[model samples]
Target: MATVTTRTVEYPADGLTMIGHLALPAGVERRPAVLIGPEGLGLSDVERRRADALAELGYVALAFDIHGGRYLGDPQEMLARCMPLLADPDRMRGIGHAALDVLRAEPRADPGRIAAIGYGTGGAIALELGRDGVDLRAIGTVNAVTTGRPGEAARIRCPVWAGVGSEDPIMPPAQRDAFTAEMQAADVDWRLVVYGGALHAFHHPPVDHAVVSGVGHHPRHAQRAWRDIVDLLAECLPISG
Candidate 1:
């Protein structure tokens, strides 16, 4: 069985105590660790489940909370809480750094072999960290919006994989094309996968809100994204077990 632990870390910048879930591999020594950033709703059961799945795959997974113990199902409120952080790149980078620090401090984690994965707004945060030169082995995102920061793509030294739904309004084809161009120009190793007929938040299962333009979940895309993430991590941060 996987060893799952829960803890809280204090973010001095926001003065908020963020909760996190750590999933450690059962019998590994100094395993590769992943810092997971939650979607717009913050840290929820869905994020915990993803961490547990990663732990089951013989990796140390840390799912960190960007929002401080507050979650609302309402879309407007969720946007209200997440938009401010997205608008300010510096603040987003600070939060990501704090979460990375928390992951690096874990005893079971190999600090040198760390990666990051995020969804939606969380994915944006991961991208910001990469832009700030976080030294991550790899970075992965799902349905993320690029803020077009100057020299951002050039700063990312690690491989990046971005997954998106073809139908996702937030990540239109033009944006994806531009992002790919930037990555290529920067010589950043990056790949993008666009799923046909899939929508945003594809990784969240059993979504109640089916509104195409609003918040919802898509389990099929989520599972596929997870598999891609595992493969990417194995390639970037190879582990011998």
Candidate 2:
């Protein structure tokens, strides 16, 4: 693995002091960057480590926050905050744009070669960014099959890839179908991967806190999803030496 450096970044978003984790690969040249959004529970070590891993693979990465500095371990609290936020496209775009601005402003990041990836609520935010006509090389989401405002998906200027567990009640077949329909109607280059026998948040590892029903980890599918994401990035935003 390449040497990786990390730091905490504080920025203003949604009237909160959002704290994010930035990871840079060992190099002086401006490199391709990726913005990673955390699940609705908020940013955690898992997302931070993901940023570090992306940096090791030679991409500057920022694991953006959702609920400012708070990690809501309580399921009710997470839903209470995220449900309404998800309903508002403008709010999601605001948060996403704030993080994108931070990543683009980083000295190590190449502003033109950035992608957005997220899980659950985070994934929804990434989609909102694309729908808002943000210039992104690629967009990837896991367990976040959210449809945007009417006809807004046509604004997505990059390839979109989404992954969902086949057994996930939160993102069932209907939701996945709706998301794909929107992508298709917009003529967006997109692909969806359904991991069989997995539940919601299957890409996420086992957590210590109590999670909502129909959410569990599938170690095999999780690894596969990661590889799929890496492939998407490689195809859309290749890293150069």
Candidate 3:
């Protein structure tokens, strides 16, 4: 494993002081960067560890925050904050752009070669950024198969890959079909993976806090989804020797 360094970065977004986790690889050279969005619960250690893991693979990664500095463990609280936020596209774009700007400003990030991968609510933000016409090499989301506003998906210029549990009530077949229909209508390169028997937030580890129904961790599928994301990055925004 390569040496990785990390730090906390504070930035303003959505009228809140967002505290993001920035991770850097071992080398001094600018490298391809990835923006990681945490689940609706906010920027927890899980997302931070993902950033660190990406940095270890030689990519500059920033796990952007969703709920300012708060990690809402209560499912009700998380939905209370995220439901309205997700309803507004411009707000989501603003939050995503703020983090993208921070990631681009990093000395070790290759601004021209970046990808966005997010989970749950964060995944919705990633799609929002794409809809806002951000130039990204790839977009990956887990358990976030949100379709954008009418004609907005046409703005997505990169390949998009989404993963969801086959049994997730939060993102049922109807929603998945709508998302794919939009992508198809826009002629965007996209793919979807459905992990059988998994549930919503299947990628996340078992949490101590109370979770909504149909939310469970599936370790096997989680690893497979992660590998699929890495494959997407390698094909679209590869690191060079």
Q: What shift in Å separates residue 30 of candidate 2 from its native position after superposition? A: 0.7
Q: What are the per-residue Cα lDDT tens digits for candidate 1 across 27-123?
A: 7478889988888877888888888888877778888787776655667787787788888888888878888887898888999889999998789
State the lDDT at 89 in candidate 3: 91
- Which order, best to worst by lDDT? 2, 3, 1
User: Each prediction's Cα lDDT score?
Assistant: 0.81, 0.96, 0.96
Kindly report which residue pairs in candidate 3 clash with one another. none
Q: lDDT, candidate 3, residue 200?
A: 98
**Considering summed lDDT, which 10 consecutive residues are worst modelled in model 2?**
232-241
Q: How would you encode candidate 2's per-residue C-alpha lDDT over 126-226 as one tens digit per residue?
A: 99999999999999999999999999999999999999999999999999999999999999999999999999999888999999999999999999999
| Steric clash count of candidate 2 | 0
lDDT for 176 in candidate 2 is 94
Q: Global lDDT for candidate 1?
A: 0.81
**58-153 per-residue lDDT for model 3 (tens digits):** 899999998889999999999999999999999999999999999999999999999999999999999999999999999999999998899999
Tell me how candidate 3 scores on lDDT. Answer: 0.96
